[model samples]
Target chain A: MFQWSKDHLLLLWLRLAASVCAAILLLVAGFVLLEAFEALRDIGPVRFAADASWHPASEADQGLYNLVPMLSATLFATLGAVLLAGPLGIASALFCQFYAPAWVAQLQRRIIGLLSGIPSVVYGFWGLVVLVPLIRLQAPPGPSLLAGILILAIMIVPTVALIAESSLAAVPEAYLLGANALGISRVGIIFRVAIPAARSGLLTAVILGAGRAIGETMAILMVCGNVVAVPESVFAPVRTLTANIALEMAYAMGDHRSALFVTGVVLLVMVVGLVAVTASFATETTHAESTHG
Target chain B: MARGMVQTSGVSPMTRQPRQRHARWLDGTVRAVVGLCVAAVVGVFCWIVGDLLLVGVPELSWGFLVEAPIDSGRSGGIAPILVSTLAILAVCLGVSLPLGTSAALLLSELAATDVRLVRVVRRSLDVLAGVPSIVFGLFGNAFFCVALGLGFSILSGGLTLACMVLPILIRATEEGLRSVPSDYRHAAAALGITRTRTIWKVLLPAALPGLVVGLVLGIGRAVAETAALIFTSGYVARIPTSLLDSGRSLSLHIYDLSMNVAGGEPKAYASALVLLMLLLGLISMALSISDRWLSRRMVHT
Candidate 1:
């Protein structure tokens, strides 16, 4: 009885802590909603969302809060980053899994670990000095959409590669042996059998990388030009939703401040949407794996 | 029998050599492509670090570490900024570790892993992990600083960071606990040990390295953050005497120095160098310690 009671007490204590962790996310969402309510009440959701011009600097009554410009920039930059990173990340994973000598693979893995460990601010600083200037010489107004995409691509490559590599490693050795027995070449086996088998895991890697690219702030803030206009080309300056929030939060007051909170709500919604997609892919792969096992 | 099989196939040795040569050429080409990708990563790292050191090393001096900002950070030191960063880190780690470990233990040992409640908890953690730091900054401003009446202080910033890093900590700790062998539990039970004692005495020690890895990662996130801290901590440059006092972090100091203050670019570079060194130190220390611990555990087991 005493043992059972002690066990029960411990379980209760742990359950409380677990609930605390869970409660935090709810609270964050709740607080954001409560704060965003002021802006929604003042400007109906449709008009606020439909309008593309976001000139919040005007007098409070004359303000306009369309988010399409920044939203498109965010999507554009993330998509570009993902497009660049996805192939390289998957290719690197294949190299590590199949082609590289053991020591070379270890060295690459360590470098990747160090890369991911470096802070985003450091990357931003580097981009501000090096990448921005390189872009400036090639195209005027150097802090352009291309710079943001490139920096984000570099930042996410390690993450995507690491995840993809792990998934590739999880591919059963028996499959490789079966391919070998059929006289398939090493490269042929890797492309035809291994990659196809891990396709869902590879997709998960890309989705997670996309999430990182979208959520990224400091690095993009330094190089994305912070302009509110829609970007016409890769060399055009634009602002992301995240960059906008960071750039203007200091002096914004009353409804202007509340509008930024609404922007936060939008960012939250986008990220949650991405997470939902990632979760579905993750579960689907796991379910398939379990049934195969 | 193998020789007879080759003879039966009736392929000349001359044809076989060409096939072998073709296979070798393919191998070399594939290896070269992969090698190029690895080189690109190395090149980027070297370029960033090399450029920073060339520009930043001359500006770093003993005076820079000890002195307070003068002339809007065009000259003087980052003493207060360093202190405030440590204070925030302390608060963040203090709040996160115990709660995260407890939650991980609950999930690994007590709860059924595939249950609805467990699934809900894990899913929410994933969503929390995916939320942008900027959004967290807004939420922290609204909830921690304004509504909770903490009022733009280190306490508020730390609390916000704590929430931001909780998902990572929980995931890491849960993985650690799950990795421990089930035989330890069975053996403890056979010895008439209570479930609580078994976890404290056996499971935790075995899971220590994994937990440490999580701790290191959480520390990294807390240290690197700027936007979230700006709202919650309010960016006061002086050292805080109390938890409620506002503080400036190293990342924010670099941002302000470079962008807001005039003639502050050199100082920003110098501080960026310092931040880089600190992160490198943390990562190296974590890697070495975990490696040693794992090796030692292997020898013992």
Candidate 2:
């Protein structure tokens, strides 16, 4: 009876621990929302939509908190990164799956893993020193949206490649063999059969890559020139929502600080939405596999 | 075209030769393109690491790791920053390990009868994992630094990192726990072992490699973090005497040196190299642990 009671107590404790952790996770979102309420109420949703630049007032009266430019910059950078990395990453996975020798594939996987583990700040620093200067020779004042995109693309390639490789691996050998038996060429089978089968997984990879790119702060903050304008071209300097928050949160006060939280709210919504979409895709993949199996 | 020829009808030997030749060309071209993509990724990796080595290696010395900064990090070693980074990592792991393990246990061990609870926990963890680190920074600042009144201290930073890394640790550790064979649990039950004893002695030992991998990955994320810590832990470069004191992280130091300070490039490079080497060591450690675990399992079976 004592042992039973002790085991019950242990279970109770575990339950309490789990519940507390879950509540804390919920509180993080709630806290951000609660804090952003001040800015959202004061700034008004209409004002955020209005065509104005980000000039947070030091005093009480004169601030324009338009998030459009930063919001657009965030989208543009993420889009550019996904566009650049998606094909390259998928291709690398394909090469590993089909073309590379066993040792070479292992090496490639290890290298990609190492690339992912390199700190974002280091990537940012490298971009600032090397790529920024190289861009400057072509276009003066090289810290532009292009720089951010390139850096983010590099940062996210591993995410895409690793996921894509696993998904490609999940394509059953029987399917490939069936295609081979049909006298389909290897390249034709890959393009037609394997890729089509792994479509949802590939989409999940791209979406997750976009999620990483969109939320990225330090690297984009370092390379994106911190200009408060919508990018007219890839070469144009721009600031992202993340960069805006990081650049100002250090010194911001009152409404300005609340505005940063508002930025956080926007970022949280974007990420959560991406997560939801990925979850749906994951379910769909599993469902399809279940039905087929 | 070759596929078309193969599918449609039997072809004459003369025509089949041309078609086979065309198929070979197509395969070769596709192979070259895919290989080029792989080469590009590897080449970029080489470029980044080689660049760091060329510029940063020259700056590395014994003094670089053990002295305080001078002139706002223009010239000096990173002893204080190193101490602070390790301190923050310690606090982060210290807080996260218990919470993450318990939460993982709830998922892997205790929640089997409650599918709804498992689904809810899994979904929330997925969402939490996707939340941006900058959002985490803001939350830490607002909740820990401001509301909790921890201020810009290592305690606040570490707690914030704990929150950010919890989902990762829980997921990884849960995977580890799940990988343990159920036969062990049955065996323990046959021996009349308590549930806790089975978990502690039989399950957790089997999951140690996964748990260690997860811990190392969490440490890597916390160590590499800059934006999240910038507001929570703060930018004070002194060696902290307590958790309440503000301290600079190595990543933050490198960021400030390269971006904020002029003529701080050399030290920044050196700091980056050190950080890179540390991360490399952690990665290899994870690899070796998993490798050894796999070998042992193979031998045992």
Candidate 3:
């Protein structure tokens, strides 16, 4: 009887602790949403989403919130990163999965592990010192959309490659054996069989990579020229929704502060949406695997 | 036209010979492309690490590691930043580990019987893990700094980072707990030991390795974090005396020195080099430790 009560008490404590963690996440989402509603109350959702200019300082009194230009910059960087990282990441996964020697594969894993562990600030410092100057020699402004895109691409490649490699590795050995029995070449097996088998998982990897790239702030803040206008070219400097919040949050007050929270809400929505998509893809892949087995 | 007429005249294996040759060439091209992509991945890693060491090694001196900022982070060392970074790391790990471990225990032991509860907990963790660090910063500012009235101090930063690392902890620790064999539980039950005692004595020791891995991973995230700490932990360059005192982290030090202060670029590089090495050490340790633990478990089983 004593043992039973002690066990119940311990279980209760554990459950309570776990509930706190869940509650914190809920509170964060709710708190940000509440602040977002405050901003929306003043400016409404339509103008906040569709306005082209982001002149928060000039219209601070009236709260003119324009997120189009910043959202475009964010989209351009995310898309650019996906375009650059997707092929390299998938191909490297192929190398790791099918071609590399065991030691080489292990070494590749270690390198990517270290690369992914590297902090965004360190990447930003490297970008500020190396890529920014390299760009400045050719272009007038050192920090531009191209710099942000390049840095984010490099930063997210390891994530994409790691996930892609794992998914590729998970492809059944029987599939490879069957392909080999059919007299398919090594390259043919990888491209025609292994890749197709891991397609959904690979898509998840790319989506998660995009999510990482878009949520990135300090690195982009360092390389992306914090201009408020619509970026005209890849060389044109721009701000992302994240950079906008980081830059303005320190000094913002009242409705302006709420506006920054609104940007956070937008970022939150996009990331949650990406997470949901990736989760669905992951579930689908698992379901397929279970059914096959 | 002549070639087409010839293929039509002999359309069996004669035409197939050229097609096979073309396919071989295409296969070779694809192989080359894959190899090149692999090289690019390795090359980029080398480039970043090589560049940092090449540029930053000259500036790294014993004096640089031990001294405080002399001229707005231009001429001084990173003593204060190191101390505060370690402080925040300790505070965050200390707070998150118990909460996360208990949470993992709950999920793996108690809630394992409840399918809906497990799904909800897992989905929540996924969403939390995917949330942006900057948003964590915002939430930290509003919740910890303002609402809780902890202000912009290490306490707020640690609390925010605790939130950030909780999902990592729960996921890793839950995997650890689940990996423990049920035979141990059965043996304990056969001995007439209470369930609580069995869990405490049998399950936790078995899951220690996985819990260590999770701990290391959480430490890595806490150490590398900058955005979440920026608002919650105000960037004071001096050594913090308490959890409520604002302090500078190595990550924030690198960010401020490089971006805000003119002539602080070299110091930024030096700090970044240190941060990179620290992160690399933690990650390598995490990998090797987990690998070793897994192998040892396999041997034991």
Candidate 4:
């Protein structure tokens, strides 16, 4: 009876299941690699990387698949959004975690929850009705990097703010008390002690915000006015890899479509690599904070 | 004599000077700046939601919600869109929960010594989690729809979403499982319970809250999904009788409506509103259940 048990049965199945799991992992990698090879074959590595123009449908377009402008545009938009939303998110998080009265903290938490809950489509709609015209009037062109950046930045704020707040809250109350006892001002304590103590978590929040910005499609598409050229200026319309994929996916045929999927694959690889790096940094920081500090 | 008496005496509370008016002004200014920063973040949320509700409500009518995509808004109901949404949700849950939980169980119970396998699984999940919805839509369309002959059905889209949400679910389940104290396992083992039985009976209940949270987040992601389903699930403006049928989700419906794809703006706005309501309802239930579970956990603990 003991030999006929659940643990024994599970052990019997584990080897089979583990191999299947490994195969499933290979499936995604295989899918991405096959598609990527097709893209390279069509465009070649040199032309694809060096050419800064991406005109899929233009009659007179040279075969330049220069993704530099689009790549920069994506990076700039993400960077711009972080610049706009990151500090403000951190400040609000500080206020929530430390300075705010209890009721205010609860209210702020609730507000952040609600804000994060709003769907991405709704964010795009809001950008469509409000930001699009606003950008057109203020900027040189209607849908430029600035417009996309601003909207994307807005989308990332709640993400950064909420995560930062939670991490800040996780900081041991003892550190703050010690800083206070040393006659450190409130602001100084926050800047010097609290923030540093929660550095790893805060970094994670920022990285997550960056991830959100890069992955975002609809809102950026609505406002970026994807022109598929290297962004000459901040106010110039340019295509992001994400927007490029979304715009072309529906109508693209044969190589045109497969090419778009390859674009997605590239974006995925880039994002995954970056996130891994960020996580490594965060891990080191957390270890340093816990074991060393 | 006067200096000694006055200086050595305890200082009067009243001797301290009031802050200069300039300092006061600076304090007020600094406070205002801080207040504005706080308001700036909060204000955006208010304005966006306010705009949505205001713009969407005027067109929010029984006709818009019930009616399907009509050329001149004469006919078409979101009933079909609603049905498709439910179908996708059901399939998403079914696919993701098992895959996520099984992987999590392995991480918790087995593979205890193999750091390489653990690292690989974690990275795979992380990569999967970070892939954008647009990318998911692309691969999902290719693998499931074209290659496998699932053919633009709810199953294809739902399966894609499952992949999308699997990482999140696994992370949540792992956190939940990690929270299960060693004492419980020891207690079970002391009674000579099988490891699998101990995990099934003791650990799962203990980690239910985190698991619930992960499930909630998964549902939220699945519900709001647009891009992946857009490619694989062809825009059929009908209620799906089964998961096998190609369908349109509420998110897709809203996108089509907003983009005036089928030239149904008002109806799209209504669908957006409906989508918001459904999502909010799911969120509240998830929260309450998690909350209740936590409370019960506290009592039992």
Instruction: Using TM-score, give the best candidate's number.
Output: 2
lDDT of 3 by residue, B234-288 (tens): 8899989998999888999999999899999888889999999988998999899
* CA displacement after TM-score superposition, residue B143 of candidate 1 (Å): 0.5
lDDT of each: 0.85, 0.89, 0.87, 0.74
Give candidate 1's fnat, 2 decimals.
0.56
Check candidate 1 and list the clashing pairs. A51-A66
Tell me chain A's TM-score in each of the predictions.
0.95, 0.96, 0.96, 0.88
Q: List the residue pairs that clash in candidate 3.
A: none
Better of 1 and 2 by TM-score: 2
Error of 1 at B257 (Å): 1.4
Chain B TM-score by candidate, in order shown: 0.87, 0.92, 0.91, 0.82
Q: How many steric clashes between backbone atoms does each model show? A: 1, 0, 0, 9
Task: Give the DockQ (2 decimals) of all models.
Answer: 0.51, 0.55, 0.50, 0.38
| Candidate 4 per-residue lDDT over residues A80-130, each given as its tens digit | 999988887787787787667777866776677666777787677667668
Write the residue-wise lDDT of candidate 2 on A1-293 in tens digits: 12687688778877777776777669899999989999888887777768366788735446888899999999999999999999889998987888777778878888888888999999999999999999999997899999999999999999999999989888887887788878888877888998999998899999999999999999999999999998999999999999999999999988788989999999999989998898899889889999998
The DockQ-based CAPRI class assigned to model 1 is medium
Q: Is candidate 2 or candidate 3 better by TM-score?
A: 2
Evaluated at residue A183, the lDDT of candidate 1 is: 69
Docking class of 3: medium
lDDT of candidate 3 at residue B240, scale 0 to 100: 94
Model 4 lDDT per residue over B1-301, tens place: 0000111233355663354334346545645665677898789878876776777787776865665656533246676777788888889899778767777877776766656766678767766677788878877887888889998899998988887888878887887787687888888888887777876789888888888888987898898888778887778877687777998888877666666554565566666777777676666666666667667768877
